[model samples]
Target: MAPSATAHPLRGREQGNLPEDVSSFVGRSFEVKETRRLLSESRLVTLTGLGGVGKTRLALRVARDAQRTFTDGTWFVDLSELHDADQLAQAVASTLGLQDWSVRSPQSVLIDHLADRRTLLLLDNCEHLVGPVAALVQTLLRACLGLSVLATSREPLGIGGETVVRVPPLTVSAEPARAPAPADVPGGDAVALFEQRARAAVPGFRLTAENSATVARICARLEGLPLPIELAAARLRALSVDQLLERLDDRLRLLTRGDRTTPSRQQTLRLCIDWSYDLCTDREQRLWARLSVFAGSVALDAIEGVVADDGVDGDLLDVVTSLVDKSILIREEVDAAVRYRMLDTLREYGRQRLRDEGDPIALRRRHRDWYEDLVLRAQRDWIGSRQVERVSKLESEQSNLREAMEFCLGDPPSAASAMRIAAGLYEFWIVRGRFKEGRNWLDRALADGGPPTVERGEAMCVDSVLAALQQDTPAATVSAEEARQVAGRRLGPGRADTGDAAAVARR
Candidate 1:
């Protein structure tokens, strides 16, 4: 447990405002230390991360720890409840316990009060109030030489000379090859937080050899998010560890029991997400739900093709930027291309919204069609100088392509396109050394009850090639003969390329 602001009252020595932390603060020693170090070197330090990752808690802890550094004392102000930009200065002034009898503006009063004072202002939840916060921060820094601010938000305020630190989820242990020792169980920060919260909830809860593994699994599944872990730990009052794991896939419902003493928005996992969701514009929300279509990370072009639809009207890139800013989507660079992914929990939330507002089947069809075209383009580019580039792109989209294949093989099959896509990636499989998996997908699509057609011939050709690579001569021979028969039926022995493909497979 950390010392609350109430425990250390503001007396004659210190002259600023800070709140008492009601709940026990969990792991984040490194984040707190690094944040303080950053604040010392930079006038403005912003802690940025997705909701429920504990940016506010970490910011408070850092401010509390750095009380002695500022001669005028450290101040804490939460901006989540503040909505009006016009009242932003009043909020800050009120938090600092400032009394102004003069007719000066609130912003001016704040600057004048802190003009010669060395102090820290810790601002929490600034994403919704970025414009006003940025303007105020810039103005204060230029006017007051002794003022420093440590702020937390989903994104940076982007003020000049502001140092931004991205707060990552707590570290979890890697999946063990065998049952790990109880001593090693507490090594991970996420598991530590879970255990601490669990003990507090159940009073006598213990992390022995029996439940350590399952507890670690829960921590990892929650992606080391502090709030969800705490909520999940609270449920252990009734549910067993294994039962908790079973229900975690639908985590928004599973982790609803949060700290009752906290704010309404902080009382449940869904509400935390709702808070962030409500802050987004209509276009940003629509794009967020639509992006749930991706099975894994996707490039900018894929997002544009899939997300820019009727009812959702905005520049696709701009909407994506907004999502990234609000921490709904995570951006990463893969193979020199920018790709974005939603956390599994966030993706599930977006998927529910997508199903509610739009037709999931229609969206899936479009997704399948786009992936089919992607395979065909990769096939075309595989023979050119861009072969390496194409291979990388296909590798990144492999999960999405698999999703497309599953959609195609769904009841009432779209077998023709399925077979075509599976077969089109034949070169990709061979070049990327995934022949076995490719052959398995091709086998499934070929048997999916499509009428014999040119695509079947193409699939047979691909299957024959993969069979040859594995040195399965009998299977290769069978596939080659099938290709020849299909080619003969579809092209009447007139297609030279089909005949050549059949001959190569037979050899």
Candidate 2:
């Protein structure tokens, strides 16, 4: 809900409650045109999509565009963080400049005041209380013939004669084979958007042929999703384009930089996804965390195997479908098999939830085990006719494998498991030319310095070989000597990493 009436003293009737845009509205020429056309034909129009897909922005743009058509005014009611359904009517009334002190109901005040006004109400973030919103909208439309409503939500209000428009991510160029010329940059909506936000973050930043490809790749990696793109662009204040792209694999952390003027929920990717996460039922929330184990799109069988446990005790398919309906999961088809996946930002949020509220170690171990068994199967079948299929399978699971290894390396007890997984991926690392990454993982696992074992020796040897291939002779020699020492005797454990104990001390 918005601030109290005193905080935002009632404005003149001409201003209404429409907020001025803090940043330029980027692409969506076609969306604006189509939405305006729909509003002309229908009294209720809903812009629906995933959170941070620019639904609110699009609705605002459309409302401002058609403002002159409404003789009374265009008022905006923000329901993004509002929880109390009973206050919904009062919130709308306040936004419409109504300050009735009588014992009359807020809904009654709104109806009587707007009965003859040709007003357009911009209802933002109505997904949480669709029932109340639908009822109120129905009442207003029935009473006020000149009234129109434009709503933004993850799903429809389910009202009769309502036009639902699904907003999509901005269009991004295909991954370029090579850096395109500056002429090609303006045509891509996502690239243009990043440039705009980047300029705001760093006034001197410009889209040049030299940096355009990196910007384009950044947008492509973010799937042309508006909020994430804006968040990424804001990082230009501290990070160069190359640094930004390299750090994007850990996007939830890197894209946290957001505009301060926006609401707290809109200030970071995690918070944006958190709003959606909070709206789910407990079962759906659990399923969401479990499904985050996968790296990319996952088949239903895999989802059921990983998520349909005792904790999530219901028809799993129904929960999956419900998540899709709520825009929490994206449903896709590959080779006639249906699969589901979360956006990278959403996946990271689910992973954070698993760490904060669930048994993250256990779930990550399960994820590792599942992928390990698949790797063994693929290795066994590599000699057969299905070798190509095996390659495809491993490639698809690459991110999952990396995530598993990351978890293993972090837990003290799982260092050996990390070494074993690193050993198993020797060939994959070579094929993908990821020698440096392979060496880094091996080095971390070996740093645990457990008792001398074959896994430790093998990991050291692999690290030595990778360092040699990279022409780091000193590191190669040191790693080779370490491998020999590991084969001979026990090693002292490394110091355990500390947390924010200092922060508590400071407080």
Q: What is the lDDT of every predicted structure here? A: 0.74, 0.71
- Name every residue pair that clashes in candidate 2: none
lDDT of 1 by residue, 145-234 (tens): 999999989889998999999998888868621234344455487887888778766888877778888888887766687867766776
Query: For model 2, how does the per-residue alpha-carbon lDDT over 1-507 read when each residue is reduced to its tens digit?
Result: 111212122446555657667467887899999999999999999999877788988999999999899988898877754555766787677556565433356778788888888889999889989999999999999998999999998899998989999998888878542344344455377887888888876888887667877888887777777877776776676689998887664434445444333323334455435545665789988988878777667777666666666388778889998777555677776545576767655766777777778576676677777766666666556577877666656655655676677778677877778888886666655444455456657777787568778787777777766665555557767777676666555543442211121111222
Q: Which regions in candidate 2 have their CA more than 4 angstroms from the true location? A: 1-11, 175-187, 249-507
Any idea what lDDT model 1 has? Answer: 0.74
Candidate 1's error at 420, in angstroms? 1.5
- Candidate 1 matches the true fold with a TM-score of 0.50
Q: Where is model 2 poorest over a 10-residue stretch in terms of lDDT? A: 496-505
What TM-score against the true fold does each predicted structure earn? Answer: 0.50, 0.49
